[model samples]
Target chain A: MRNLTDTELAARVAQDIPDGSYVNLGIGKPTHVSGYVPEGREVIYHAENGIIGVGPTPAEGEEDLELIDASKRYVTPAPGAAYFEHADSFAMMRGGHIDIAVLGAYQVAQNGDIANWATLDNTFPPAVGGAMDLVVGVPTILVMMRHINRDGSPKLLRECTYPLTGLGVVSRVYTDLAVLDITPAGFKLVELTAGNTLDEVQALTEAKIHT
Target chain B: MDKRLPDLASAVAPITDGSVIMIGGFGSSGIPFGLIDALLEQGARGLTVISNNAGAQETGIAKLLKEGRLAKVVCSYPRSPGSIWFERRYEAGEIELEVVPQGTLAERIRAAGAGIGGFLTPTGYGTLLAEGKETRVIDGRGYVMESPLHADFALLRAENGDKWGNLNYHATARNFNPVMACAARHSIAEVRHLSDEPIDPERVVTPGIFVHSVVEYGVRP
Candidate 1:
């Protein structure tokens, strides 16, 4: 079966975002989605630090220390960008002003609960930054991540073992193997990667997947 | 009346040991580095710092942590990629950390500044962060009661300011500075430009009433 590359997964996720949508792209793999947004779509990116209308990453030597995204990566402002304080930024988030939020996940349950912020391990300190706010505030939560863990264990599960960022908040998930939607019935398989069969994908998923 | 201070030492002189202080910034932006240096030079201990993140390694707040002056830190993002100082101290139990949700932390500080009592937020309701907090269901959604977070001193950086203390912040550098200016009992601003004349009223993001003193720092072009 052909597995999608990280950039390919990002492009697939970008294809689903509608034009002129105000979106927040979470740190890590989700940030890559901003670069793959289709041409002429005009998606306004929102950074939790205090910017709406975030633009593309700046070229080398053109980076500004003051203009940075939540990831602390240098970013240029799009035309008509606006800035505010931290409280106002989150108010825009929690008030449902953001149409969509794209995030990276460790596991997603059939019930749509997302676990991304923390693991059960004691070595890594768990830090729940803005994921809690974004998951609860944004109307549509889209998760982009690897379909399985490093040991080849399925991450799409009946219930997440890791601490959840939000309960039943995820609407859709895009992985290297397939695109799935969370429904009242369970995981509804949208499309699988080329050369992959339903049975093969289902074998890796713990939850009941409807093709 | 003019509220300008002649130097950074006098601006941060009021911060005594065991004081709760808010230092404005997101990562490295909008941080009052000059004032923080002054505080380090002053060598006060047992400080409780409120901020969005523990500053990067060997700079700003991390330096203070290295100096063993910080007793506790109340922030949303305590772990950054280069935050070795915080990580080392945290694991060793040398310092205390209260990790708040980013939005909740911002709102709590705003609540303190606005003179409002505790408020309800849905961000941390079902998460581990919500543990032991008051929870209420409003319109079928659960919310946790979060109290206001006030500090004794607020040290912030501004892009511009006038003698009257009206301030302007540049780009994303405006993150926590304005709100923190109001939440503290004494707000000291380290500004790039200290003008003899008052800043344009319409351009002021932080009104002078909230600010106690302003010190001119970095060069302005």
Candidate 2:
């Protein structure tokens, strides 16, 4: 079975985003989705740090010191970009002005609970940045992550062991192996990466996969 | 009246030990570095800082944290990758931390400025962050009660300011500065340019009424 690369997975996620959608790309792997947005599709990126129309990363030596995203990575402003205070930015999120929010996840339950901010161990102090707000506020929550943990354990589970970022908030998930939707019944398989079978993918997912 | 101060030291001189201060910025964008340096030189101790992150390592609030001057920090996302100073201090119990959801933090400050008592937010309703907070269900959704957050002093950075203290910010650097200016009793702005004439009223992101003093840093001839 073929496992999709990070970029490939990002491209797949990009395909699902409709044109002229206002989207927020969560930090980490989800940040890569902005670059793979299909041509001619004008997706307005929102950064929680008060930028609504976020543009692509600037070339070397062209980076501005102040124009940065929530990830602290420098970004350029898109045409017609608007900057406001943090309160206004989160208002856009919590007020349901954002059409979609793409985030990275540690685990996803069959009921659509997402656990991404903190783990069981206290290796690093639990920091819930803006995930909770995004999960609850954005109209659609799309998670981008790997199919399994480093220990080869399934990430699509009956219940998440870690702390949940939101309950029943995730609508769809894009992973390295396949695209799945969180339906009222359970996990519904949308499509698999090339060379992968339903049984193989199902073996890695603890939740019941409805093909 | 004109609120422009002569220099940074006098601008931050009113801040004494044990002051609850809000330093405007998200990470490093709108951080008042010059005022931070002045505060370090002032050597005030037992400060309660309110911000988004605990600054970066060896700079801004991190330097103050390393000096063991800050008694408490009320913020979200204090554990940035480079925030080792806060990590060691927090683990060792050297400093106190009150973590609020980022949106809740901003709204609390906004509430303080707007003179609102408190509001219900769904951000931390079901998490450990919501522990000990009052919870209410409205329309079948749970929300936690969050109170307003006020400060004794607010140190912020602005792109330009007039002698009247009207201010403008550069792009995303405007984060938290405007709201913080209103939430604090004394709002001090470190501005790149200080003009003799009042800034255009329409372009002023922070009106002069919210500011107490202004320190010009990068004024060009």
Candidate 3:
């Protein structure tokens, strides 16, 4: 069975974004999701670093140094864009004004606990930017990442061994191998990548995947 | 009152050793680099800093960290790209780091500025950052009790400043500057446009009362 490429997975994830929803895209894989947003759907992007209505990347020479996303990448402001300070910006998330957040995850437990910011590694400093905040208050948390670790270990787990970003926070996960929803019961299979079987995808997950 | 200062060195003169200074900016923008450089030249040792990032490379907050001027840094993200000084100091156990969730940090600072003693927030609940903090379940959601994070001084950048010290920022560069302005005992601003007239009162993002001084940067001769 063939797995979806990261780009393919991002495109697939973008298809699910509801039109007119206010969304925040985390760094890495989740950042690409907005680029693949379905045609005719209008999503107002929020950058947690203090921008609402985040737009497409600017041409190389046209970058406004003052305008950048949370990732520090240069971007144009979308029509009706607004800028605010960190306080008001995060307030949008913490107050549940932000409808959805697309984040990257290290592990997602059956109970929807996410661990992304820190691992056992202390060689590099642990930086927890807005992941916890995004998970804590954003109504829907969509994690986009690989189905398994680089070492081939499962990232969809019975329980997360890594430090928790938030408890029972993830609403759904779009992985390279499959898409799943974290229901009240547990991880439920939504769909598999093209040419992949449910059993094949289930084998990679440490959590029981209810079809 | 004319809050304008003659130079960067004078702008940072009030910041002393052991001061808890908040530097405004997220990533590479909105940093009061001129003030930070002046603080570097002014040579005040042993400070605690609050920022979105610790700093990158040898610029802005990184410069302060590299010079061994920072004793502790309260921030959300510390390891910025090219921020080798933080990596070195943290690994060497030469610095103390308090990693707060980005939203929590902002709210804490806002709490101080707004004169609210403390607030319950869901931002860091159940995470290591929330450890030992009083937590409660309110309305079926868990929240951690966090205190206001006040600083002795704030150094920030703005796109424009008027004679009255009213400030307005450029695009996303406004990040922590506005909030930090109100949270500190003294706030100094470095602006690209320091004008003789007050900014349109309606357009002022930060009122002059929050600012203690202002200095012009990127001025053309």
Candidate 4:
């Protein structure tokens, strides 16, 4: 199947999410998943600032300053939304309560290692933040990212060259070009975007693709 | 009462290997470049660096990456070239890398600084972010794992600092610096300039008491 657009990509990803699944969407494009969650599926959105039952973005002129996500972006609280102290929010992540974590990655290796956080340049610093906790805590890690860098280098690689966020954490990857599953056998092609072929993606990737 | 860059380096002599250190910034902007330079000059290796992102290659923390001085890195995103370290080390089975989500990164460090033990966040609930972790339902919604954060040293940067060590941030560059500052045991504030008196109470982003040392230098990248 050809996934034509980001919206379509989101909808496709949403299809796999079961009803009443607890999820955390990373910043940037992953934040958009809140809008695409299947209707009446009871998906609870967790903001790092301690809000759940996250509704979609609000209508114009109806913004709530008190309601915001982890990224500080304004949001609409769902019917059952609840808020708590920041401590309580982290307890949930550390306690192994969350079911799914979709994050953006700079690169994912054949072994499912994730290197989304820092680069290796000494002159440039690295920020580890909570990725270490999340990668180790979460069970099914999904990486949402572009297929390639602006310089045309592959973010999906035979091996990551950047500092890793977690070792052997990522299980699935969704990119602008294709959806792949990381296995001991390497990256298996699940689907491709419209106008992209397996060969073209393979040309850009350092790993072999099993259709 | 005041000292030059060399003196500042000497004051920081206690910083050592395996130390959990915090550096302030959002992405690559607003980092403590001069102190980082000092750390580079001092050649403190095998450090555990905590920041928003590793600096760009050859500019910020990337210098540490090149020197191979960092023992481990805890961050939200490590950008280009710096990523090569993982490839050679992890893929080749030599080094260790730990990843964290952006919001979770901010909250964990903030939690540590605030003297809180832990909290529930829905950020990484259903997918891989929840693996090998406990899950709880608060009001019928599942929230995944969350961990508390703390550090030995916090290296921060700010727009201005009062003699008392009060500080302020420039903009979105304010991301994780202030929060990380509070969570560490010792904090060093590096600023572009310092004032004779304390900054206005309302404008002070980080209180002087939380900060032990002040480095006057160029603004961080």
Q: Per-residue lDDT for A64-139 in model 4, tens only?
A: 5445665556677788887543345556665577788888888889889888656765544344445555676667
| Tens digit per residue, CA lDDT, model 3, A46-97 | 9988899999999988888778898888898899999889988988998899
Candidate 4 docking band: incorrect
Candidate 3 runs further than 4 Å off: B219-221
Judged by TM-score relative to the true structure, which candidate is superior, 1 or 4? 1
Candidate 2 residue lDDT tens string, A1-211: 7899999999899999999999999988898898888998999999999899999889999888888999999999999899999999999998899999999999999999999878897646767788888988997999999999999999999999998889899999999999999999999999999899999999999999997
lDDT of 4 by residue, B88-125 (tens): 44354434556567668777788788887887766556
Backbone clash pairs in model 4 (N, Cα, C under 3 Å; residues 3+ apart or in different chains), count: 106
Global Cα RMSD, each model: 1.5, 1.8, 1.6, 10.4
True contacts kept of each: 0.65, 0.66, 0.93, 0.19
**iRMSD (1 decimal) for each model:** 2.2, 2.9, 2.6, 9.3
- C-alpha lDDT values of all predictions: 0.91, 0.91, 0.91, 0.71
After superposing candidate 2, which stretches have Cα over 4 Å from the reference? B219-221
Q: Which of candidates 1 and 3 reaches a greater lDDT?
A: 1
Q: What is the iRMSD of the candidate numbered 2?
A: 2.9
Error of 2 at B6 (Å): 1.4
TM-score of each: 0.97, 0.96, 0.97, 0.55
Model 4, residue A136: distance off in Å is: 18
Q: Which ten-residue region of model 3 chain A has the weakest summed lDDT?
A: A1-10
Return whichever of 2 and 4 wins on DockQ: 2
Query: What alpha-carbon RMSD in Å does predicted model 1 have with respect to the real structure?
Result: 1.5
Can you give the lDDT of residue A35 in candidate 1? 84
iRMSD, model 3, in Å? 2.6
Summed over model 2, clashes come to 0
Alpha carbon deviation, residue A112, candidate 4 (Å): 21
